[model samples]
Target: MTANLNLYSCDLTDISLSIETILQVVRESKGIDILINNAGIGKFALAEDLELDHWNRVLTLNLTIPFLLTKYVLPHMKRQNFGRLIHITSDADHIGFAEGSLYCASKFGLRGFADSVRQELKGTPITVTTIGPGRVDTFFNGKKPGDRPISLNADDVADQVMHVLSQGQRCEIERIYLKSTFE
Candidate 1:
């Protein structure tokens, strides 16, 4: 039978609601085969001029939400003995970007979090992977490929995710970094 899928459109910054929703889903669902922590937000602001609220919002969505969701899902995954978690990070997690201090910090934090959890889940069927893309041409900033010629398309990242999931049960791809050929 195909695994049930539920897509939640709640804001990640709302911790209480997000955590509650995650717990409720896992508690009610039969099993969670995979959890993709893809929710994220970006903000363009210099470190010196960054607003506190903006930083919090970006960090909340990019970092804390994934952590909370993973925390709630771990028990279910552990019991089932099979799970895959993918955190959609960014190249900025390694290479800092100008005017993107908040975004970089949040993504970097997510990368670290995923790494730690991957290690913690060692010897278990629950595998964690982090996919970092350079620049995806999405509605992230309400921009299109015509508006930003060098950006990669969202499908590029989606394909990578699918490929990772297609790997054999005995194999696990830890990380993937996709960049635009033109960049």
Candidate 2:
């Protein structure tokens, strides 16, 4: 927590374009210790009506971006022998919905990717985890607080992330599935 926080603005989906920034960060700081793949985009569309462009866009942002970010930071983390990579997937990852085919596909792919990466990094100090909240009030969904289908607060999700990180080097929390009390 004492390390200086640095923010670099760029389109994560375009990893090739932004990799130099990561290279620079690693060059300057020696290595990275934490990575949070929390960026995602969602647009509900039926399988029949889902366009190829939209499908690619959704998948690129939700799935591809996380993988790329994880790719660049991995070597640094491995050299340091300590790191954490967390992906913010969704309940859709486990359950498919009629009109949410694209969104579900992206999330499901992400979940699978996270699982594989976790196994790949087993012997190292790096850990891969996913926080799948049932639904949230973020821009991801149009739901308001206390809406018909209950949703978890964004802060609550962040809290869970902190809880996972607080476990320190002693625990390896694979994934956390959060649900609304109503669910």
Summed backbone clashes in each candidate are 0, 0
Q: Candidate 2's residue-wise lDDT over 1-183, tens digit each? A: 697777777876676766777776667776687888888888786788988988888898898888777888998898888998889898888999889999999999999999999999988778888999887766655655656446678888999899888887858899899988965
For model 2, where is the 10-residue window of minimal lDDT?
140-149
Pairs in clash, predicted candidate 2? none
C-alpha TM-scores of all predictions: 0.93, 0.90
Best by lDDT: 1
lDDT of 2 at 95: 92
Candidate 2: regions farther than 4 A off: 141-150
Cα lDDT tens digits for candidate 1, 1-183: 995577756756789889878877887788888889888889897898988999888988898889898998898889999999999999988888789889999988999999999999898878889999998877686675666678888889999999989987778789999999998
